[model samples]
Target chain A: MFRKYRKKSPWILHYNAGSCNGCDIEILAALAPKYDLERFGVINTGNPKQSDIFLVTGPVTFRSRERLVELYTQMPEPKVVIALGSCTCTGGVFRDMYNVEDGIDRYIPVDVYVPGCAASPELLIDGVVKALEILEEKTKAIEKPFRLFKEASSENGIINRRHSALKVGEKDEED
Target chain B: MSKKTIHIPLGSQHISLLEPVRFKFECENEKIVGVDSDVGFVHRGIERACTTKFKFDAIGYVVARVCGLCAITHSLSYTVAIEKLLGGEISKKAKYLRILLLELDRIHSHMLCLSHTCENAGFEAMFMRIMGDRELVMEIQELLTGNRIQFDYISIGGVNRDLDVQTAKKIIENLALVKAKVFSYIDEFTNNWSLSLKFKGIGALTLEDAYRFNAIGPLARACGLPIDVRNEIEYLPFDEVGFKMQTHNDGDINARNMVRLNEILNSLEMCENILRGLPEGEIFTKLKGKPKGEALMRFEAPRGELMYYVKGDGSAMLNRVRIKTPTFACIPAFSHIFMGEEYADAPAILASFDPCLSCTAK
Candidate 1:
């Protein structure tokens, strides 16, 4: 139902996972007039369940790891996660810092990685736009109907649960 | 009969909060009675990293990562402290370039705080307006330093880039635009009835409370306490570049917003003066020495006073790098201000304090 509109309107859920505020501000600037990510019908939502794109900044910290995962899980399926900035990608300058994990991908799957010390607003706008394409693919994958190509068995076309009876095109020796 | 107080918690993550900071407020009716904040969420163990992983020369950039908003200040203070230990004199042109970047940083940082404060108050248009105008400063920053957010502009003996004629023209043009927008904001903040009502008497901090709690930056300045690191530090020629202390006595959100607005104007004027008096000298000076002693450097970050303490043990690896960020210092005062105010106003009040948790956590 949302296929056509989904690509046009991708709601964003932004979370700061222990970043230096560089990427976070850039994300806001992207939403601002000059770069204007909002022109693509993108709305920054606080609710994870309603969001289709999760824009996460900073290298995941010990304390924020749980929040990062929780936010990711809370976001509905067929979602795109964009890691903004080098720190969020591979910990950047903060790679060796004790409390920081290498990047957010250590805790969750990231589809788009935009790297910079603090990624520029222009780059952030580009990242979000790229996320829209990923979001479209995930949405298509989720909504695509599954089809059965062939029969499973000769007798009843029913697959057996037991491992010994689970032969595809041949009966088990005991059978 | 005894009255029961209700507890309302706002973030380690919340809609109004941009970063992870959790505060539990115990409220008696609509008034907040107690506050407990947890600001360690953004801590990256940067101090430990400084002493062990990075060399003295490279720590300037590492420390800059502490907070993006005040990155320039962090690097400048760290570089200044290192220079003090090295005991070398950089060119006057280099100092001017450093000041130029510092003032530009302050302008953007204060504008961010003001815009954030507007956002938290549910003034969407005002927030967008301020944010849209902020790009003017950001454009200049990018032109001068080649990056918007993390401009690793300031280096040990000098700056990373020099200002060229084209960039200088861009800086002057954009700063004028920012200055114009700032005036309109000032008029809106001072005259708008709804904004005045929401901000005027809400979350008020008296001069006595400000002093007792040791508030710094715009927070203290708004309360009429003249505690500005810019005035105290002689390392940079702040006085030569027309640095003025902006203060307001009311100590409410409105007062703090006014202070920020006025400071932005002052910073714009300084940037103009710096560009106008473009001196001829080298931007970087090569100083040959290993840092051996301890040095404490303090500068006025946009949020407040940023202090960097560096103890180098003559080796490439230093002993300790402690950053006393303004947000960390103002936590006590932040909690104090939350008391006796409506729980609804918490976000606006919090934004007005301009807390930088990354800086604090680092």
Candidate 2:
């Protein structure tokens, strides 16, 4: 019954961590009339307390990082985070830009990943559906809240967040 | 004696969460008492680069890249400007092709702005539906120009490639599909009470304010001003083509979206008319010599009026090329629109202007 409820209503909060509006435009395109996502009960909410899924875009900027963390913390439990577009998932073409924070997962833990320059409508809708499943799982584990990346170390502290999948001292290509 | 003064270093570096606009948002208790904008980021010195780096005809392709979304418009305006300077006349058939491509571009760019605005407003379903429909426009562009985004189709004197009969038929068929979806969504979106409440009068800018700001595109048109460049400029046969100029008096975000949506419909019809009445002739005019004079050409890009000022020396290379994008003209308008609105509505309202950072910064 709870699983069905999660599927029936997955409230989302979209945050533009900072991007070229291309991906951001694609994200919005997924919501308009032709895609008709409202039939799935995937509504967008401005309030974090009401949101079950956080659809974060762009390659989180340095200045927006703290604000993002604050927003993430403000959300209620049983939440699933989705990093939308190539920028949030891997920084895409802007990986080398000085101001970009690399990727959103560098700051917040992400459960579902949608990849595209600005992801297509089909892909974005699919990602939202997948996030609802994750939301269902988080609801079951209410007592423990939710953990995204198991490898996320507490030692780094909030100011210096390590990429969840990144290993210590590894010279990996920055996503 | 009473004295008060505070200096907040806004940006030639930071402040705007979107494009590289540095502004000092001087506030007294969260009310913006004063604002100052410091532009010129990613200036790449494109104007200077155009004069020194590119040949007269080659610059058409370079200008297209100035704004990824408005690429076709920039290239179209540039080609026309150069043709005027060269004193060359494009074939009637080429004019029809130009009209077809421009309308297709307008549809794509407007849909993008609508969807992005909905996204910023936290409406995902609306965004998706608009975007899905947007692909049809992009597909049409790709069919015409071979590339989805920056279509290097427009050339000096005329188009580089002709719109094949088969492709024209496909474009017409695709537009039919878009029409169905667009109408359905418009009905759904306009009827949604929540969407209406969120957008209706939230970002209202008076006609006077818009005039003072010198807003362009849907923003200016939404305020009841008939400022379409197509209405003013002397293009080949746009006069014979029948279509209504889209406008609204609400002067708010919703009005802007409505204007864009209507423009898409009008654009589709314009494309169909051009295809049906396509004239048969050469795609480009043969030019053997160097350019000799300066030319100013303007066009109605999806965002608004786009002006191209090109100066050619007695050589193949251009001496100077200056572009005044619609968004550049709307900077003062954005400031005016931003006044007295909550911080939350700032970005969405700003986006409704269809501000392309690439075009403005260039």
Candidate 3:
């Protein structure tokens, strides 16, 4: 029940891993009146634990790597990560610099990548929409039952724990 | 009764902060007594890369990524420095166009800062209104430069794009609308009661402290120091466009807001002046030869004075690129202003300073 509602409204937490202010401002513009990203039921939150989407910008710098990882870990399960710039996706211009760690994917798993020197608001809105689909899929995967027994009394009226655990979900039938 | 002090920390990642900047504050009761700031989170070693990874001509684009808000000022300063070393003169039309884009950049940047300030002061509606109106300036910027943010219009010796009559008409129309909106903001900033509670007489830096701390840009100008790079730099024709310095004596958050608002009006006027009498000449002039010696260039970014020191060894790759950003220069004054203010007002006060952590760290 909560999973269905989770897709309706997903709060986002924005973290600048080491970006120029361009992408950051664009993110704000996405939320502003012109873009009105909030019309899609998205809100920018400060608390990581309450957030369902993580919008990470910039090429991850050495000093910000720890905080970036910590923020990713703090977010609840079924969360989606969107890398919001070319530098955040592949270290665009800051690649091979002394301080940057190439891209953010080196530190955290990314679900969607929005590529631009400074990602435009249109691209950001599109990225968030794609993330909502991913978030829904992850939610469904998490809620699925681990196994279903064929019969309650099998193998001399004893519960077959091994057999029941062996058939994981419904996909094992094809396998 | 004994007096005790408590320690409070804000940011690295606070909701109020747009960037990653950490500040540890020591408070006695409701009053903040001391502040310790960390601005190195956004540092990406661009200074080191400027000399090693990129050549002289490409460095202009590379430096623009240093701070998105002041990308034009950064590239313009670096290009002007290279022009000085190569000893070439750009056409007057190109100079006028450069000033046009620079002023447009300032208008949008200042609007962003003002809206952010309103958001921090707990006025979300005003934040939305200002941001909505700010799109007018952004539309004009995109019409002129082909991008909303990070316009790479500037190149060495000249600008990359030329102005057209259609775009010029649109820019004037937008500027007039932005000008009228700014006047309404001036009234609200001065007379609004809720804003006055958060901004007026709160987080003030006296004139003596501004001079002592070596504050620059609006922070210094708000306190009546009258320090502006546009007034001093000979590389651009600021005087011809009727550039006027805006200052206030109150030195508080309200004064800073007023100063930025007034500057936006002045910048709008300057843009109109440039478009009205734009000289007729080629936009781009191809210059030959590598930069042989060192040159220093300075420009008035929206925040403060941006200085670029470029040293070339007469090769394709230069020696060093040193960037002295405005926010980095005013850190001392920022810390000083927090003293004796209520801890609750910290975010609003900090917003008024318009600290660009990316610029400072880079």
Runs of candidate 1 with Cα error greater than 4 angstroms are A147-150, A155-175
lDDT of 3 by residue, A35-116 (tens): 9999999999999999999999899999999999999999999999999999999999999999999999888899999998
Residue A150 accuracy (lDDT) in model 3? 44
Candidate 1 whole-model C-alpha lDDT, 0 to 1: 0.88
Query: Residue pairs in steric clash, candidate 1?
Result: B11-B22
- Candidate 3 residues lying further than 4 Å off, grouped into runs, are A148-171
By lDDT, rank the candidates, best first: 3, 1, 2
* Rank by TM-score (best first): 3, 1, 2
A15-59 per-residue lDDT for model 1 (tens digits): 999999988888888888888888999998888989899989999
Clashing pairs in 3: none
Q: How well is each residue in B193-232 modelled by candidate 3, as lDDT tens digits?
A: 9889889999899999999999999999999999999999
Instruction: Name the top TM-score candidate.
Output: 3
Clash totals for all candidate models = 1, 19, 0
Indicate the residue-level lDDT of A10 in model 2. Answer: 84
Q: DockQ, in order, for the candidates?
A: 0.77, 0.09, 0.81
Write model 1 residue lDDT over B111-152, tens digit each, in one string.
888888988999988888888998888988888888888888
